[model samples]
Target: MCDVGETTWLDATAQAELVRRGEVSPAELAEQAIARIETVNPKLDAVIRTRFDEARLEAAGDLPDGPFRGVPILLKDLGCTVAGETTAFGIGPLRDVAFPFTSYLAEHFRAAGFVPLGRTNVPELGTTVTTEPKSFPPARNPWNPDHSTGGSSGGSAAAVAAGLVPVAHANDGGGSIRIPASECGLVGLKPTRGRVSQGPLIGEAWAGSTIDGAVTRTVRDAAGILDVIGKPMPGDPYYAPPLPRPLVQEVGADPGRLRIGWLDRPGLEGYLDDPECRAAVAGAARLLESLGHHVEESAPAAMYDQEIIGHFNTIIAADTEATMRAFELLIGRPIGEDEIEPRNVAYRRAGKDLGAVAYLQSRSWLEAWARRMADWWTGHDLLLTPTVGAPPPELGWFTAAGPEEEGVRIISFIPYTAQFNMTGQPAISLPLHWTPGGLPVGVQLVAAYGREDLLVRVASQLEQAAPWSDRHPPIHA
Candidate 1:
């Protein structure tokens, strides 16, 4: 007989199957996740809320037939709500903005038979790349505690990487999910815009600056969550077209030879990337070649410097301001200027001064980029690049008190990610590298808009050729 407690922390798909077959109870699985949180979160601080009582009651109820029935899940702390639970986004200003009801995403997580374990952390207002926030210390990487797990979905990545759960919910607006997934060795997908709903709370956060997804140890688990949670409400701003009859079939099916456009360095950024980052892309290009895909080195003419940085910052900063302002008003107190981390303060200040004309110009430029990139994609199946130009830095690399240095570091490492956000393309990060010290590195894959099925097919092929889920951390049960 299996020990339910010991097995509860197993891959969520397995746990759900076990629960359905009566080998273990949902309560047992919930207890196992809670135990993991208690044992490891003391050092990691990955989660800010633990929904023990509600999870137990919810688990005890009749469940809908689903692949994830009775499995435990964690939601990131920003923008999602669980009716009576507060979301802090890893900052203190909006710490107690409890909702009287669940958000649509919260309800979707529940309807899929996933028990809510709690809320995880993110960067301050999710503006910065590192997870350290003024509200709490950084969410440390489980593989090596000194390095960061990446953000704005750092806490979810940390919890998943630490084995507190097999997979945890994550959202990306400019590489939040993929960045952390790369740093922590997980599969993260940022579905093309409109693949999932941002409804009932508001239509698409941050002017589609945020995308909700998951970080999972297994490709199948990540795909499974997408099958369940990837729905657009009736009046969504847009919707990814209907998927296949069954997503599981798509994951295991063959992705016939693909035409890949490979860029080892970010063309838009101009400066060459570190050798290791370039090597990772070079190495992945070879892997794609071995997998029988036709790979080549070419791109649309390099973009102007001012266009990439200025427009991305303007649109993203404006979105950040709107989210923070709403949060501040709901909390019934002004956010003390001194309370926030330095970068967020600077962004909010910049956003307030953008004025209508500048903001519109930025939006217009983003549309132009989308048009240019979408046309470029017509001749290729995928684009391959390093997810981030640098490896995961020590925890405080970008969160130090010095703003100018932090700004430069952010610019250097984060350029590749925000481009996908601007393009509204489906992008993913696969754990394809292990550094000298055994830290993970990620390679990025981008597909044209509304082509998540294609992205997953290619990712699944790579994962099958070189599977990674079994690469556990030092703390194995």
Candidate 2:
């Protein structure tokens, strides 16, 4: 039996090899994982739904034969469908909620040989950065319990950082994947839109702004997972050309003297860069320069477009309303007054208020901006920006007294993440910087659509230089 507790901290790839060699059994790994979750999760509130009995049964039964074999992984509650498991997506929507049948992704998850331990927390509809949703208490950063773990993938990030699990399922529509990765110091890669499917369930999520991926402690784990499940199913809305069989094979491949447009300053929030964020970005920029990559100060031409920002926000708010309406229909109720958050009400109301013209105008603006970004990336292979425009806001910043507080300034600080959502490109948050206050700061690297190979390859190079897997929270098992 495998005891992750006693054996070397083998990443997913190495662990699979050990499993094949009979050095680590799924039962042993599951027992150690359950123990870790018991000891560590109380501090972070990461794993919201634990299927301990189910996990044990899985370990006792026939395991899927894939690269990850017995690795324990958790799915973010918001973006995925697990049969028999209801998706509350934050706002306490579990009243008689349950998955009616299995999803294609669930089958793929099993095919990857990943043992599903349970689900993790996300903001209501994954609309916010702080994981403090009404459904479950906000997930606290394992590094500092008082500080927030970033969301809507916050739980997955916390779990990986605290060693509760090596890697967990995470998704990003806006900055959900990168935000939590920055806060928790993990490798968060938001694959190009449609790189992974939203199918055999729902076709598109958030107007295709968001897509699914994982947050892992090591780059190689991310690479292996992508290899197993990254391909889009046939007859999809869109598809990126297939790469080599193992994405990890490209890791450490020459990034070469590529031109990397780097920004030490935050833009989307309009002068919202904290001293810590700037310093972190600056330091990371220096590291990239020394690492043989050409770094140039460049800002997205789209950064100055207020119309685009408004367009993105309006669409987001409107989508919030649409999703709420869908939930109401799902539950066979009107969603009753006071069932959703106050800020959300404002946004949803704003969405509902928009007439047909405003929605169409928003669509036009998105097409224009995507063209602009494509032209910009055409000249440069990649653009580097601060992962989060502002550092993680203090916990409870989003919901005061559980959403009674309205128009939170935290939303204003989050513009840097949404544009990528609109552009539908591949972006990632690498934990390359940590503040003097000991908070991790992330720098985002983006590639043109279908060029995740570039981002992940570059990330592997950066990982070797500034390894984050060794970094850990003060609280640990």
Candidate 3:
């Protein structure tokens, strides 16, 4: 067998190329990824469970001939359930509950020729923005062991950042994908809502604000993976506007001169106005200008209105309650307050008490607010801002206090990502800047609804302009 160590830092696309060239077999790639996880996951606590034996079997057998054939990847613990595998959703009591069927997205991942190595850690119910569930140890940032790897996809981000896997399943509801990507220094693309299916189980998550994608070291992997999994599935409630062509084709395509607006601060009150965060956006703005895109300081007026926080929370509360009830059906028992995190417990209570009229009011308000937010994109091709309001916070910062206080802390850090989720728009987080202390800070570029094609094109251009592929965290494999 070839020495698999050489493939450690290769992106998913390059790894697949090696397999296509007969330089390495599928089993070899799977074994190498398993080894890397064994070596690095202990330090990061990124991976929670393993299906290594199954992966080995799959690798040695006939596999689909797809772009990422034989490349190994991970699934987040929260969603993307695999048949008969543990679907813990990062709660302690549900750790051993096995899903009877696979999710559509999980099937798509396999069809794309990727091997599922294991499952990554996540926040409880994926409710918060940090992955410090009471069920398991926190997924530490590879860049700095004491810092967070933003949540609910934090474990996937950590694994990818540390070279455990080139790409891993990640989903975003309220910045779950982008925030972790920013914290862990990987490329995170949250596709337009309905771009990916969450079917054969549920149609929408977090009132249609959540969507599945992936975190990768390069823009091409992000695009390639999306191409593999972003197809419309049977029973899907809705679908994003069809891409003109495969997303991978958009990579390196000229985006042409486009107008891009940028914001340097968290426009909402009570949210952090972090200097490093602002500087990251400013640096990205300058880089876009240097690449010939017209950049200016502007943002949607609706984004600043604090009313969004309450309306969004209303939806989250109701969803959290509904998710708990669904889990009761799945596990054959109701989850107690002590069995989950306090924040989620609070959400459950609020949701249970929320009247139907109140829930609809919040949803209607946000829907209208989304239209106001989308108006900015009519005159501009992109809206750029810091992916998060600050650098990766030290672990426990968000949960050090009561749940109410934790909610405030989370809002303070993530002011920019959730709104796009509500609007069903596509946004990407690119690791373009690093703090003087060497932590990665990502900047977000958002496009109008169904404009992931535009996002892919410009992201590819930025990838070429400011290459971050060679950078590795100190704790990487």
Give per-model TM-scores.
Answer: 0.95, 0.94, 0.99
Candidate 2 lDDT, 189-234, residue by residue in tens: 8887777887776666667787888998777878778777776886
Of candidate 1, the 10-residue stretch with the lowest lDDT total is: 298-307
lDDT of each: 0.80, 0.78, 0.92
Per-candidate total of colliding backbone pairs: 0, 2, 0
Better of 2 and 3 by lDDT: 3
What does candidate 3's lDDT look like per residue over 382-443, in tens digits? 99999998999999999887777998898888889999999999999999999999999999
- Candidate 2: regions farther than 4 A off: 2-4, 7-9, 268-271, 401-408
* Candidate 1, position 176, lDDT: 93
Ten-residue segment with the worst summed lDDT in candidate 2? Answer: 401-410
Clashing pairs in 2: 2-25, 173-210
Worst 10 residues of 3 by lDDT: 1-10
Off by over 4 Å in 1: 4-9, 268-272, 302-305, 475-477
The candidate scoring highest on lDDT is: 3
Instruction: Give the CA lDDT, 0 to 100, for residue 39 in model 1.
Output: 88
Q: Sort by lDDT, best first: what order?
A: 3, 1, 2
